[model samples]
Target: MSGLPDILLAAVTGFGCALFFSSIPVGPINLTIINEGSQRGFKWAWFIGFGASIMEAIYCALSFTGFSSFFGNPGVKAVMEVLTFVFLLFLGAKFLFVQSVNLPATPLRAAAEKIEARLEQKLHPRSAFLIGFVRVMGNLGVFLFWIVLTGNFMSHDWVADALWPKAACVGGVALGTNAWFFALCFAVSRGHGRFSEATLLRLQRLSGVCLLVVGLFDGTHIVWQLARHRMALTS
Candidate 1:
């Protein structure tokens, strides 16, 4: 409506964009969540998403609220890049070497029965939340990602400059991200029985390999660029 406040419009639209971005099937974290949901129930899945959403909100706020410039510093950038690289490598190794999550995909009713029969292996609430938080944080440099995302929105005139609207947009990012994650969890929870343990293990290893390759390439590129920049400055 024409009567809609500019900030509200930006926030709403920005939220849609963030939701789409979060749903993009790129990251290991999403795969992990799906696997978790497919094995555990929806409660476990949602808790993981909740933790991830919190971090996503924090970063979105930082990027949109002028803290992005602070992270753009060379030292900070380097540190984030290095940490991401190391974490990705370690995660990949863990995926390759550790016992994969191989829970049998029983029907929801059956899963509940089994849980009553014994302890459930699905991530519990506290574990899921903390794990999700740690997993999201491992994908460092998301601050720059949000900055670029918001900058593009501004460039395209899809966003407003006012403070409240910007905050709203950032909140939307978290909401959108959480929404997508919840949707993913819902889908997985419904079909958890369809996934065989072999299938789950294969997917896990595949995602791990993908993460490793992405980290190696991206991490090295960042290091190379930093080195070149330093050499140029010194020369």
Candidate 2:
């Protein structure tokens, strides 16, 4: 650890830790990336990672700049939390209901191909990118994520208020996210054939159920907190 290398080394280390901690969680974004990676291919996974990482970088910057305070208001925060809960439940329901039953043999394969071809046409690179971006952006929880991360950094006095450190950290997050998605996509791609359609369908249903439970638990917790806070304010 000497000269510019010291700073660079520290930045890289910080980046890796942040990325690992942020990505290791079993969130909606991870679920989406893994699902798409297995069903689609490398390209699909890359785009999802690209879009999500870009947005994540933006969130990091916003957090560093203290722009996420908009959600600090109680009413606004509660509303956003409820919305997130609803989205989680909705996404789960969709996954649970959309069962891809096995089709008949050769004759039906032709018709399925035709339909798949149409789906392929629609799921262009741009579409994949948009889906990733929208999926991450629509969730208000991410705003809180960066806000808390930045706040923790500030409290720890880890990095100064300099621009370069912030940029480095953000870049590190993007790189880390990309790395995780790469691994996930590669692993899922390997299982493409081994997992039958029914298995995938069950996995989807299981994901939905997990998400639904998460929403219910979180929604209740948030409501309880809100009630307590309201009581405190009144008292």
Measured by lDDT, the strongest candidate is 1
Question: Candidate 2 lDDT, tens digit per residue, 1-235?
Answer: 1345434543674577455544442455666766787778878876887777777778777887764344445465556666666766776676667655332245444554455455445664356776666556555566666665554343333444566665666777777777776676676677662545566577666766776786788678777987998999999
lDDT of 1 by residue, 48-148 (tens): 88788887888777676784454445565556556666766776676655465633333643544454334323533348887776555545445556765
Which stretches of candidate 1 lie above 4 Å from their native place? 1-4, 67-126, 193-235
User: What 10-residue stretch in candidate 2 is worst by lDDT?
Assistant: 151-160
Error of 2 at 90 (Å): 25
Task: Give the Å error, residue 194, model 2.
Answer: 6.3
- TM-score attained by model 2: 0.54
Which residue pairs in candidate 1 collide?
Answer: none
Q: Model 2: C-alpha RMSD to truth?
A: 10.6
